[model samples]
Target: MGFQKRPYEPTLFVKIGENGKMLIACLYVDDLIFMGNNKGMFSYFKRSMMNEFKMSDLGRIHYFLGLEVVQSNDGIFVSQKKYAREILNRFKMQHFNPTNIPVEFGLKLTKAGRGKKTDSTFYKQIVGSLMYLTSTILDIMYAISLVSGYMECPTAMHLLAAKRILRYLQETKDFRIFYEKGEKADLIGFTDCDYAEDQDSIKSTSGYVFMLGTGAVSWSSKKQTIVTLSSTEAEFVAATACAC
Candidate 1:
């Protein structure tokens, strides 16, 4: 009953233990998922939840919100293989040839009036589908970030880039992020930025990823608002954003 709601993440509740035991629970609407190092706390919480409301115990989480979690004796592996395939089929790219990379090297996407105009609606859908896959497919983060910027007025070039991403996904749809058990739990973070990569506005893009133990817990890739004079400044901005 000593559950404390987190200020930043209000939907999450935690029971801190001084005796090296703790419980963490995430509440999403009517669904409740909780995990802990103490079995006693789990039983108590389950009993309390059952007494207060009518709910069924779904047991261990295998799938939730398009994310599939495969739990083994050593760790938990998270993936979106089914979702990725569905995306490919939804856009009729399932039978297309797979690519080695999501985005081509030295590819500089711009808003210049050169390529033929494509359906903005369709392009948005493609970019949106790939956006969620970034939840586990870290490799496509930069590519998704690039294509998402063109959603407002996507051209044929943008559409092709988006398709390339799906093709890349088709090639690497089985990728998963595994969180393995370890003697120590360390938080590690990485930050990167492309100096003036956007030709239209000459803006830099910043990206960051933070990993807890063997799996990434948080990440972001976005075009920076302000332009930096040098790569060093761009990197600093990216790092500062990452720290925040």
Candidate 2:
């Protein structure tokens, strides 16, 4: 679809098959995602598509859908450094000082009003941009998820917390996921839980990261569905959630 026609038809679907190898391309708006087992076949398909279409070859998929794609001899690394900078610049926060962490270690974000009020539209715009940035930047999942809870009617404190995340991104803008290829290609998962993390709802937050070989490609941080009485229960719940 043309850039101007994106809103009308936001997705494009294509399938390529050659010599028992199949490749699928899913294009959402301006983002294109391709998957196939055979790298050579995929490359050929991409070239063919470019020949038949007006699309510009991004060259090895370094950036797409807010994710920065890095290909190496070993594997692929994906992150969102560009998305982070876009967010910072959108909020006029590119000049802000960098921080070590996305959020304060012991800080608890609640709906209580404590900070100065600003334009709600600006706050929502920042939140939406950050949410898009998180699609490829899983490192900021926890902080983004926490701040997203206040989207309904964000307060100044919530905006500050969100800004802090931008500050954190400024410090770690160079960080990227390294998908290394090795003998150990098995999928490994890690899970952790925090009991009663949300003071307002008293709900636990669970997080998990899945690594393929030496690189992490999938992860999530979310609040648990049910309340648990103990840390063991919370951990077990988190484990079960990860299993799904």
Candidate 3:
């Protein structure tokens, strides 16, 4: 199809037809999805792909890569409700009481926290599941990242915090990230940091979320590599990371 690999996005390929029709394709392992402005060009491209490979058209994808997509008159929504429920059942928290926030305010997890050691295997599994949830559930990014730090040797306190995140998920399982379709394609990003948030390491936490108009396209929550003495410096470092 003479498509060129999209810069900065390795999985995406783009091609502009002589008729001014643009086609974009994204590949994830064996799954491929097509999007284009021209109907005729889109159909032709689909036919070409079918002839070249053994593929089935799922048509208006509802489930892909563990993310559930819902199409509506207003916009498209993505979620992971089924996965969230599975996590809850696996951890025996399916009927757990719901919580308003994923993480408690001023909560600081430490390596030297006083608690019994938890099963590393189960702790890692919970963290892994929550990490996947972060793909669509942006609100839990910070909590997931926080609990993930103790995957190697999680304690009872850490496990309790991880379960709180699950409780939060149970409360907002139906929430989805809506990507409304419109002409606007503006890209905006926000960055912030907490100075010396980590008690043990004395490292700051930096987080950023990028939005394509109203829908988030990318996001991250992690500790800074280097320690910053001032909040202004911490914020600057976070903003630089987002820009990069």
Predicted model with the maximum lDDT: 1
List candidate 3 stretches off by more than 4 Å. 18-20
RMSD of each: 1.4, 5.4, 1.5
Name model 2 segments beyond 4 Å from true.
Answer: 1-24, 29-59
Per-residue lDDT of model 3, residues 35-119, tens digit only = 8889888788888888998988888888888899898888889999898888889888988899999998889899866599989
lDDT of 2 by residue, 1-244 (tens): 2112234344634444557666656677665667767888667777877888777765567666667777778777778777778878878899999998898888788877567665778878877787776666677889988988887777788888889988988898778777675566888999998999897889999999998877776799999988899999999999998998
In model 1, pairs of residues that clash are none
List TM-score per model, in order. 0.95, 0.79, 0.94
Alpha-carbon lDDT of model 2:
0.78
Q: Which should have the higher TM-score, number 2 or number 3?
A: 3
lDDT, residue 134, model 3: 87
> What is the Å distance of residue 35 in model 2 from its true position?
4.5
Q: How are the candidates ranked when ordered by lDDT, highest leading?
A: 1, 3, 2
Q: Return the lDDT, model 2, position 79.
A: 80
Model-by-model lDDT, in order?
0.90, 0.78, 0.88
Among all windows of 10 consecutive residues in model 3, the one with the lowest summed lDDT is 176-185
Ranked by TM-score from best down, the candidates are 1, 3, 2
